[model samples]
Target: MVDVGTTLEMVQASQAGMSALGAGLAVGLTGIGAGIAEMAIGSAAVGATAENRDVFGLVLLLTVIPETIVIFGLVVALLLLF
Candidate 1:
């Protein structure tokens, strides 16, 4: 027969595993999304900057904006883990 304590420990372990998986997915998926977003913006920014050097600063800002999604994802992962 299985011991009750052992069963409880197993359940806790499974829960911990699931939490970790969730955290990993949160960070990984967001990073992927941010990367995709950056790809499009980066290409457009490059084109715009090439056409008008004066817009380089704005282009740079636009390029960096997608990175905020990664930060948000990190926060969510931390929350999930903790």
Candidate 2:
């Protein structure tokens, strides 16, 4: 026979675990999405930079844009954990 207090503790622990899992998923999925986005953009950026040196600045800016997704994910994870 389980006491009410014990059951409540178990529920709280499970909730904490779920929160952690959600936070992990949030960061991992966003990081993966950002990586996929960067893969195509990076390839094109490299090709463009190869053809025109003057376009290197624009290519670099475009290449870095996808990284923002990861940053947003980190923020979400932090929010979840806190």
Candidate 3:
């Protein structure tokens, strides 16, 4: 055979690259989610202000929903690390 060990090393390297990519995806996806959440919050805040200016509390909670995405992403990243 044509020295299969080198081919194995190449496959391992590719796997390593994939792991790195997974980490990047976690953070990137979370960032996208966070951005979306912020947009919703902004819209709600605007609407609340226009309506009664007293629903800031409810809007704040709704805005924080996106943060869960980041939290989940972080957990995935941490799991991958170890």
RMSD vs true structure, all candidates: 3.2, 3.1, 3.6
Q: In terms of TM-score, how similar is model 1 to the real structure?
A: 0.83
Q: List the residue pairs that clash in candidate 2.
A: none
Segments in model 3 whose C-alpha atoms lie over 4 Å from true places:
1-14
Specify the highest-TM-score model's number: 2
| Residue-by-residue lDDT tens digits, candidate 2, 5-70 | 687778878878888998999899999999999999999999998999999999989998988988
Of models 2 and 3, which has the larger TM-score? Answer: 2
State, as a TM-score between 0 and 1, how close model 3 is to the true structure.
0.69
lDDT: the better of candidates 1 and 3: 1
Candidate 1 worst ten-residue window by lDDT: 1-10
Query: Given candidate 3, what's the lDDT at residue 54?
Result: 83
**Per-residue lDDT of candidate 1, residues 6-34 (tens digit):** 77778878888888998899889999999
What TM-score would every model get versus the actual structure?
0.83, 0.85, 0.69
Ranking by lDDT: 1, 2, 3
Clash number for each model: 0, 0, 0
